[model samples]
Target: MDEQLNHAPCGFLTLSEDGFILEMNQTLLKILNYSHDSLIGQHVNSILTVPARLFSQFYFFPLVKLEQRVEEMYISLEAGNGEEIPVLINALLRKVNERTVLECIIIPMRKRNEFENELLLAKKETEAALKAKHKAITELETTLKKLEIQKQELLELNQQNQKYKIETQKELELARIIQETSLTDPINNDKVQMEVFYNASGELSGDIYGIYQIDQNRYGIILLDVMGHGISSALITMTLHSLFQRLISAGVPVDLVMKELDSHLHKLFDNNEEARHYSTAIYLLIDTERQKIDYANAGHPPALWQDPNGTQYELSSTAPPLGTFEGVVFKTNTFTYKKGGRLLLYTDGVDPLISNYLAPLVRKTVSLPLFQLKQEILQCLNNEKKVDFKSDDETFILVDLK
Candidate 1:
């Protein structure tokens, strides 16, 4: 315990009322840079620095005498080398034989002083940083205004895009209506009656068909399905209609007409090799004179035939699709006359095997009008359990022999 007291972190001392030091610990001796003999009888006023002596005489000693204790008074002392040493001093006054004696502890304050200096420096740095940040915020307000303008511009552009999209949709709907209404008149010739049905997947039909009166007793009927669906395919159908008229009006044979159509399309789309665009078709000529249907199939679906007694025949494909190559050969097939019979030609889209939701449409001997039959097909599709938008373009050209 004695060793601990002597080596305590703070200096300990005893002094008389006359300011004469009576005893001191090893820590106190070390703090003052003194031996025990040098400080034993020395005056306290002589050990303190001049300013410290003045502070102690005027305030520190007077306060300790009146209050019995003075706590944490910072003072300076003169070391043996005459250098100032800062200390936090605590003093207590005790009466022994009616004479006041002072007990004191002096703790070194140099590290705490350094800490205060560093704290002040940090406070200054924080203030400087806050000032710079305030300046940056003041400057950024202008940029924020500019960003708000750009945001408004973007919102306006989006509105314009929505308007344009609505307008384009209306135009597309009109074009589809035009394509729908472009069908030829019903062929109620002396020997046959025809009914046609068309339904597009979207606002346009990529599949197209037509019937033309070639002579007094012969009628031309063609079903064309462009290789794709949408605007590009629909555009091809229009060109197809124009080309078909130019050829058939000039009396081109069914096979040569197909060949010529392929050659014409290849010249437009194909380079040295095949072009990406092409169509599949089945073209036939109804002859009341010979009681025959002279027909050629080009990668098109088979025509469904129903006799008066409800017998079914599928006339399948005979050649590849058109616009693929020049002078491509197409085979012809002929079907004999059947009274009160019907022939159904269509794209693969209407094939019942492809879509389960589509009901198998058997051609009836009790035929409806052409438009009424179209409504029937439409009703059949709409009454499905689910609407499949991905459903392909379906076009059926139904011919009935009277």
Candidate 2:
């Protein structure tokens, strides 16, 4: 047992309770590069490095005192040449011949340190690579999520825009149909031959005209223009149509009809400080047997009459527009409704937008059918890529007395 302990693979030593070296084997003498005679009586701390001495005093010594053993503690010892030799130590408490001592084994750690350092470096590199890959993957996922949200928002906006366009188109078509129906078949009788032409600035117009028959001998011709365009003005035109039929059917004279119209409209629209609505109108009662026409014009354009001898007669206004005042009086004018004479009635937009360019058209086709005149005017107004109208409604009426 003594020989085996002397020549052990690792260093073996015995320490006094206060750390003086009591006995040391040849293995420990060889590892520390010391002669047995030189160190056998020395303290164990004599060969410890500064850090190892502090660690032994603080950590392993306290543990050995309490549990009486310390296992596998790494430290460095000083060699005879004053070099630090890394080692691992394990110690156990013992009592020999009534003397307290510590038995310790020392292991050289050069080969073990190299293997553990390589392992530690490999672990650090792997962790760094994993962190970088994780960051890159997270950023890519965030970008993809944002792109998907943007695409969805654009799709929804496009869908909503398409729906609005369809709804607006439907409304325009409905307004056009109602307007055309209201002006249909105003004249078709033996006593009068009439040609009517009407055009709107856009989807709706403020212009309205029609002929009402009072009896076989007497008939009323009417034209009205509201102040503005679109649905609001178109509504006022229909309201005026209703008022005309009611007042005229009640046997009201042309002047009294104007007075009643002004009073009613002013009461409804002009009661406030500012008047809201008004219109210009021409209403005429023609007697075929007497060949006389009695007319009341409310702030309208003058009627033009061209005789067979090429002379022009102007039938101008007789009163201010309706809805302007409550108690305004209206006058009546009369003219002879001669045979073979031509009467032209129009809104203000006609001469500015159409008649100037279409004068030669009418002059050349003067002897043609009256319906052709209405057709020629429509052809010019319906030409695409053209902007004849600025903002107003246009109406042209040509009445040839048969």
C-alpha root-mean-square deviation, each candidate: 42.1, 42.5
Write one digit per residue (lDDT tens) for candidate 1, span 90-185: 788898778789989888756644544555555555456566765576445544554455556556656755765675576467567766776676
The candidate maximizing TM-score is: 1
Clash totals, every prediction = 0, 0
Model 2 scores worst on lDDT over the 10 consecutive residues at 352-361
Clashing pairs in 1: none
TM-score of 2: 0.55
Q: How big is the positional error of residue 378 in model 2, measured in Å on the Cα after superposition?
A: 5.0
Give each model's whole-structure lDDT: 0.73, 0.73
Model 2 scores a C-alpha lDDT of 0.73
